[model samples]
Target: MERDKGKLELIATQRVNANSEMYKVVDFLNKSLKNYHLMFGLTKKDESMVISIYEVE
Candidate 1:
């Protein structure tokens, strides 16, 4: 995760077959932190999954 000013970027890697709980967590955090959470992408490579997120004021 990286933070700059009022923006935050998060890159989370997991198993491709695993449940994607990040979506819910992101939603919760957005409300909790009073910030907007934008989903960048979800990429899959072999057995690995990548979740990209951005939080902005």
Candidate 2:
């Protein structure tokens, strides 16, 4: 899951909150990403999160 962490890091950039729960981060990313020309695939693994992005059609 190291690759998934990298993906989240790239996506979140400097906006990541160190104290927030993974679910909260996922929710925030979900709303913010919806405003762009991209779509996201989110999966929760216990207390961690995995995000996948795809171009909008």
Candidate 3:
């Protein structure tokens, strides 16, 4: 499998609410890992809360 090196790529996702403990963890990871090239995002779509981890550019 070959993939671009610097492209924004999704690493993982979870169907969990942003108000849950999962969000806090993700937020912590973001704060702790922002300088390490990872980005965390939380969103609500279609009546569900979604969290995503990405390898940022």
TM-score of each: 0.32, 0.38, 0.61
Clashes of each: 0, 0, 0
lDDT of 3 by residue, 1-57 (tens): 776677778999888544557668778989999888999888877657888889877
Error of 1 at 51 (Å): 5.5
lDDT winner between candidates 1 and 2? 1
* Full-model lDDT, candidate 1: 0.54
**Full ranking by lDDT:** 3, 1, 2
Q: Pick the candidate with the highest TM-score.
A: 3
Q: What is the lDDT of residue 52 in candidate 2?
A: 58
Candidate 1 accuracy as TM-score = 0.32
**Which runs of model 2 end up more than 4 angstroms from their true locations?**
1-20, 45-49
What C-alpha lDDT do the candidate models reach, one value each? 0.54, 0.51, 0.81
Tens-digit lDDT track of model 2 for 1-57? 234322322332222223446556566766887666454555655555566555553
- RMSD of each candidate? 6.3, 9.6, 3.9
- With a 3 Å backbone cut-off (N, CA, C), the pairs that clash in candidate 1 are none
